[model samples]
Target: MSGQQQINFEKPFIGSIDQGTSSTRFILFDSKGDTVLSHQIPLKQYHPNPGWVEHDGLEIINSVNECISQVLNKYKETNIGEISDIKAIGITNQRETTIVWDKNTGKPYHNAIVWSDTRTSSIVNRFNTKAESLLKKEQQSQSQQQIVPKDYLRDICGLPIANYFSAVKLRWLIENVPEIDQSNALAGTIDSWLVWNLTNKKTHITDVTNASRTMLMNLATLEWDSKLCDFFDVPNSLLPKICSSAEIYGHVESGPLAGVPIASVLGDQQSAMVGQMCFDKGQAKNTYGTGCFLLYNTGDDIVHSKHGLLTTVCYKLGKDSPVHYALEGSIAVAGAGVKWLIENLGFANNSKEIEALANSVQDTGGMYIVPAFSGLFAPHWRDDARGVMVGLTHHTNKAHIARAMLESTCFQTYEVLKSMEKDSNDKLVELRVDGGMTMNDLLLQIQADILGLPVVRPHNLETTCFGAAYAAGLTVGVWSSAMQFHIGKRFTPNPNIDHMKRINDWHKAVSKSVDWVDK
Candidate 1:
């Protein structure tokens, strides 16, 4: 199945660990990016306070270990291959989820702060005020000719001091968790945490793609910016040394596949971009997971956004290769909104059933659901926004709400696409899509109708995992390039519906959701 002319091997394979917000999984993939074997485990999330979300850091490590063991055990029983045949391992994780641990003990100080958590909104506000005051002081102390424009760290980091990024999360931990303030403790995102444990603490490193998500890293230098670290009050020593996305970071010191080289690492969304084979400029993909993330490849240029989108590294194959940048549009809630309907509102017995339920209704019946559950992300970075449903009448049933929920995801993605187009000035010919939600053809149709653009889904919906595997395989020469990724399905735009009215009604509902909670 490999495109390269290398000698074919029956036993050699690549392994990947996809640690996502909702679950942990270990997938064994062949050279063609097809999953040969896999084991998945659902992760438990704790919400101890309103707008707060966390995951047990140890639990994350344990889950990864368990899945790897289970997959290898099954491999052994089937006599397909030995653990030694797994040439390399790759890792992709939810970005910006902060974890602080004792450097010596390897014990986390507190639960890993999830990217969706809004506990640091107040801290972000305070930091913004401090930055403004400092800027004003500089302006007053200097003449107009001597005044230097302050880009507010955006030009360097390509991010804002928002709760979604890792810097604010790390700052919050230092203030709230005393153990974290100790000199022995170090802060890192999930990739660094997993890499540390996987290599038996022999290495503390993170890929540029993951590091870019933290506000501490400079986009151009691809290293922790001292100015940013000082502004955030986080020591540079606390961060992992940044590495390329596809180089061997370290060898696995202990596991079923002990001694296997951990060759590649990427942030989950960046992995999806690679898996989608979006290597050229203007190519884009939207992952419909717990949240919807749309990334447009801008080649090597780091195009700063006039809109609320973020500029981030897409991937860097090696230290010598040029860094590919992307414009990212994040929607806080997508599949999670469907899960909320299923578990919280009893709209369906399973997430898959939502498709049939939504299809039961001809339309939403004028209902508009604004899934601002974790506040709006991307173009509208409103921390105070809350979920709202407008045009709900007595005639509205669960089916209508279900339809509206699916439509909410589509509308949000449409808005982000518009923003991306505005910032990049390049219209998307088609959107390559992946993730669990893409399984629902009805939802994809809704997405295509709303955006008036063709939607393409890869044969392997688990591109996030495959992307990691591909990176690892590339490092070990499993395949020459990611050009092997081919389209599985395509949904063309059927823009017959009056989408303008629906979008207007959605905006009206969203307006009510803004500033819902008082400070």
Candidate 2:
């Protein structure tokens, strides 16, 4: 597998704990980004109220341990290597999920505030109205906030004070929870909490990529902006020390695989960059999980989009390493459309079935289902946009709705990618895609046709886990370089009828679905 010099067959295996919003997965990868084995466990989510999302932090930690144990145990029978030869582990997680835990006891003080949680809108309103002095401090010091002519946290973070990030969550906790307010509470995102748990509470740290999303880190400095910390009413002591994405964050002390070094912590989107091997400026990738995320590599320059896209850290190699910046956009709903179909509409029994049903229809049959369930995002930024269907005729049945649901996701991505191209002027010609929805050929084809670009999907669809494994593998000298990995597969754009006309009608359908925002 060597591009030049040959090495022995003794490459150490690297494991990754990809704790995401939907599930927890443990993936083991060899040096060349090839999967050796894997295990995944679905996580339980609590949506006790609208816009209030929570998860058990202990469940998150235990799932990681359980997956590692399961994968290692199963790998014991493989002759490729022994369990004892495993080198290290890397972690990539859904960023912005907030938690407050005891520094001494390692117990979560409350359920984690998921990245999707929108419980802090009123809190944000209060800050925007009352905390002008504090907001100014943050605006000057925080790099992302600074990128915009000020008032840019929502612009550059692809988030708002409305609670999809750690900052407002921390603010809400500190204000409402009595225990956290009066003590030295350890407050941080999922990465910080997991790093703490893994190191036996020895390391309370997070990487630059994760930090940038918090509306706390200065994009340029890659450090916690002291002013923003104060602006968000977060005590300086409560935050985690920021580090590089690829350095040794901590080491495992006690677990199914103890004593292994933990390196390469990344937000899931950034990790997918490492997985897709998007190393150059203008390279872009879109992930279709519960929601859709499009990220374009902008090199070191943070473009600070006028459109509703974010300037965030793609990855930080080290404390002193040059940070690769990215422009990111988030859609309100994607695969959640399929979930709604199954759970609410009785269209299908499972998510995988939606692909076949979507394929059954030649067209959406003049129907459109804009899934603005929570709100619209990206260039639209219409928090008022609510989920609604338009142009539904008698012929518009389950298949058409399935197709429309799938097309809705692509259109949302198309909007973001177009905005990304305009903001960075990169003109994305190809996009690497991963996550659950990429498994759908019908969806991928539609994505290709609509975007008028090649959509490359890797053989190992688990890009998030693979990226973490790659990072860890590099740190331990297992996969010395990611450049050696081969391109697994490519799904090119297919010819469609009346491209311009189809686009017009599709967009026309979209226009009708508006005005439903928050009505």
Candidate 3:
């Protein structure tokens, strides 16, 4: 509704293909950042084994095509503008979701290994052991090293050796899927998968933001690292070329927006950062989605996290533009925790009912939930952690558990924010939030209460899509500069509540969740 400003027939529009973990959406936005037309399709997730998550690669492309067709049809019905008025398309997707396919026939060797999948935990452990052995050999030959083996590549790739990244996922495919090899296979994240399919298999490229998450790209050089490839045992030839986040990559081969330049590509979290207009250093934004991601803009300099946070590329607007960097804290469970409440615990019928249920209670009555369903990410990269709901009693009912569920996300954000503050050495004045979870006012207030920082939601909650739209729009001159959207809601922290005690209790609950699965 915020984008309902008078539609100028003369102005051009931009389209963003948001390929998330659970859904795919095609959104058409005018120069003013108004939604001209949009369509979304829910994606199916497959779990053939516990700790494994996947998506059909072909299904993802098909869903994108379907969304594009539906949105274009709606645009035609409205007669707002001709399809030709859409200048370019941008893509923002779930980072670290690995897909491998044949370069010639474009048939996937296996389902896309989703970012949330932990089937590669064994692979991670092996790599960590190998790294430690290598480090021991070096230490015996030279001076003792201070750094841990798991963080051996952090200086180069800005990521820990964990299963949450693309390298390990790619490694698992290479080892497990026998057919995949350098001869015919091409591998990359979802952005590469979509671009290759959209351009009729002509363009095979991934942007800097997506490349950073692969844990194989050199953050300084912005290219695939040979050492990392060797470490993961993945052939460099099987990977796509790395490019800047905003540039004309190629044209869509067919459909309603045929021949339109595919101008930009960013991992979803980085796209949200751009959409939030957090260009200045020290600015930060949190996206509450399937998982929660808080990114603190560090401008051009890449600040290595002394804490457990990650240093990553925020965005590169064009090939010539300077690469902006950021400190990122990733929580693997946020909205997924809510979904677990609905489907597993049977708390309510839908997520919207969660707020009402949470609000019905005054407090959680000392209850605390650590939703470490797939281990814990950021600040605590514990793969052994499991879901735990502590401080339960006879008085604790559905409402208390529901409130604790919501508070779990807030508490996770708080931990990430604290780590980010220490890593960046800049205290954030406020946190700009976006995504579906921000729609819940009670959640935002709880977030503010927990973090003791103002939580600001944009007038348009579609920042992830709009961030991609902004990148593409800027490239095609749909807009000369980034358009600023007004704030929709702001929740200030309550001074009376002592948040630190609750945070400490959250840490205790988290400790209880760890080492749940025996090594």
Candidate 4:
């Protein structure tokens, strides 16, 4: 757990690339789902304008290659034969972070529009206006008709018109960047970019899980919808071919990992769900990363969320297997808000220190930080929302602010969990959690206290990588099923404390955060 462990050449191994918003990591996992070797590089984010975030697409690919090379090189010194032991490589990446590149030269046309970027809010507003106009026109034409209120692409895509999706980002690039034209353009999420690069451009493909997040893929058909594509103005040719989550897409043709089959690709949140072994309906997991994502598995049935949750494909194990569906509540900011407090405000030097600083105070001292930085996601798809700190007083200090920061994630998560229950119609018995934020015991305790449910942490915090590895391992027969991981720790809700008042106050703070920006 502390450092790179020596790998055995005799045993089969799986490599995973976890390309996230904050960092790019390559981890080598043995057949038992234990990390044998790992390397991580922090990614630099560029904020050239307000509410706009971009990442150098080339730099992201370079970080991925560097991580792969470093991890493989370390294994080479310990066991040269182990390089051949790598049976397959899997990928899990930040979903909906849009990237467009030249198909021939292998160069990105512009910086990657990150999932958290709000530059396309104007574009989203345009779409919302168009939808409203169409609905109004229909209502005027038939006053006596029982007009079923048509949800704008919700039935087909399970997403509303929002800046968080890849469609709006792609549209923005096509309209704004002159170089990104139909002649030489190709658009994809971070998963597609990584796979296309890793396979030496032989495979321009994404799995069902990654595709489902695009707001372009049809949830029922599991393919790109032409009508949706035409509506979004993204050419169907620019999109990657959708594939099953567990299949050999291509082989790595360069570097130390040449010829290793690329067998799996999953969105990070869906991968975490798989890594947590939430394969059955009603099972759920919350990933605490740069942002918080809570996914509840609904098996094969696609339940259109009556609540604000998005319905998405969980994973498809095989080409012919029934595709699993899930209801997801994506919180726009969790750890990123924590990072903002640490680096921007100097609340703490390191993220782990926030716990002690926050614990210094008995509570937030009636303070609440609603981190609607890029607007609220999930149940409330309000793009106009912005970050708000309410209930501040003369007695409020940094410790209270720190506690409020951590509690923001808990409160956001609680709202999402409630929405999930409303959609699934089943109470989530316990919450299985993994990711970097799970390392903080105080955060997990807060999660349990807020939700009034037991919080479960896996033996490995890097379950995002493990989930991709599990998919690849399943393809190459490393493991038959995802039954290897065990519970490392559990935090049950405290019955002694009633948190309704605190939660109710947090809701008031969130209300103030919404609609801060008007179109």
Best by lDDT: 3
lDDT of each: 0.89, 0.79, 0.92, 0.88
lDDT tens readout by residue for model 2, 63-118: 98888888877766545576567788889999889999877777788899887777
lDDT of 1 by residue, 389-499 (tens): 989899999999999999999998988999999999989999999999999999999999889899999987889998898889889888786566688999998756668
lDDT of 4 at 211: 91
> TM-scores across all candidates?
0.96, 0.91, 0.98, 0.96
For candidate 1, report its TM-score: 0.96
Model 4 residue 262 lDDT score = 94
Supply the global lDDT for candidate 1: 0.89
Q: Kindly report which residue stretches of model 1 are placed more than 4 angstroms away from their true locations once superposed.
A: 1-11, 138-151
lDDT of 3 at 40: 89
Question: Which lDDT tens digits does candidate 4 get at residues 383-431?
Answer: 8888999999999999999989999999989999998888777898999
Find the 10 residues in a row with the least total lDDT in model 1.
1-10
Candidate 1, residue 509: the lDDT equals 80
Model 2 ranges off by over 4 Å: 1-10, 77-80, 130-162, 499-519
Deviation in Å, model 1, residue 58 alpha carbon? 0.7
Give RMSD to native, each candidate: 3.2, 4.4, 1.5, 2.0
lDDT of 2 at 241: 90
- Regions of model 4 farther than 4 Å from truth: 1-10, 137-150
